[model samples]
Target: MKDRGHVSTTQTLDLNDAGKIIDAGIAEAERIGNPSNIAGVDAGGCLLAFARMDDAWRGSVDIAISKAWTARAFDVETKALAKLAQPGADFYGIHASNDGKVMIFAGGVPIKEGETVIGAVGVSGGTGKQDQGVAEAAAQAFARG
Candidate 1:
């Protein structure tokens, strides 16, 4: 144990920050007139906080969480994946290869602290653009606070 190499490190979100992200997402969803399902996840793609607005679709729960997880895991918005997964692209057929966990839709945004991506938030239960906007609002809230 005398010759230790460099150690790796990463930032992760705690419950407080995750809750903030969720709250902001909820507010955004309400403002947009589209009650949504929202989720927050740490750097390792573990769910930290979640919110399902009243009358939200029951099926959107998993999709929202998966959007956050996928964003954190890949450091890319879920919707952007759609472009990369198109036919003849490098990630073509990637959708079916991930056990159906991947969500290539607009509803995920990374939570960054400075240049480091600490976690992510995802939103669903509305149009893709609406979902993406809500997620972005959540991320901005986390950044500001």
Candidate 2:
């Protein structure tokens, strides 16, 4: 019988990892002067940890969760997904799907282990660019550790 390769191990994030991501995001958001809501999700697209900075917009909490879920669900940066989800694009109207849990905008970044997406980080409460910057920093910190 022919042998198959060993089953690949899955990468998962724990609460500690989530804390790291959230801390990095908070740091970036503070530096940018954009108090923000940040979220982290595990490989299964389940919420792991979340943080809302003081004075952050209350409305952004849901946005942050949705963004994280969307990133892990689709395994792509939401900023890049925004383009695909644009009118006349492949993913047009996607935001209207997923029971409205899809956030087709910046601020969501998938955390990867090699070529595999293990989790995601999301931020909200500022301009799209500011949120995106915070999310990226959060994910990068996880990637480095």
lDDT on C-alpha atoms for all candidate structures = 0.89, 0.94
List the candidate 1 regions with Cα displacement exceeding 4 Å. 1-5
Residue 11 shift from truth in candidate 2, angstroms = 1.2
Clashing pairs for predicted structure model 2, backbone only: none
Q: Across residues 1-145, which tens digit of lDDT does each residue of candidate 1 receive?
A: 6656677778999889999999999998889889899999998889999999999888999999989988887888888987898889878877675578788889988888888889999898988999999999999999899
Write candidate 2's Cα lDDT for 1-145 as tens digits. Answer: 7657786778888899999999999999989899999999999999999999999999999999999999999998999999999889999999989799999999999999889898999899999999999999999998899
Candidate 2 positional error at 117, Å: 0.6
TM-score of each: 0.92, 0.93
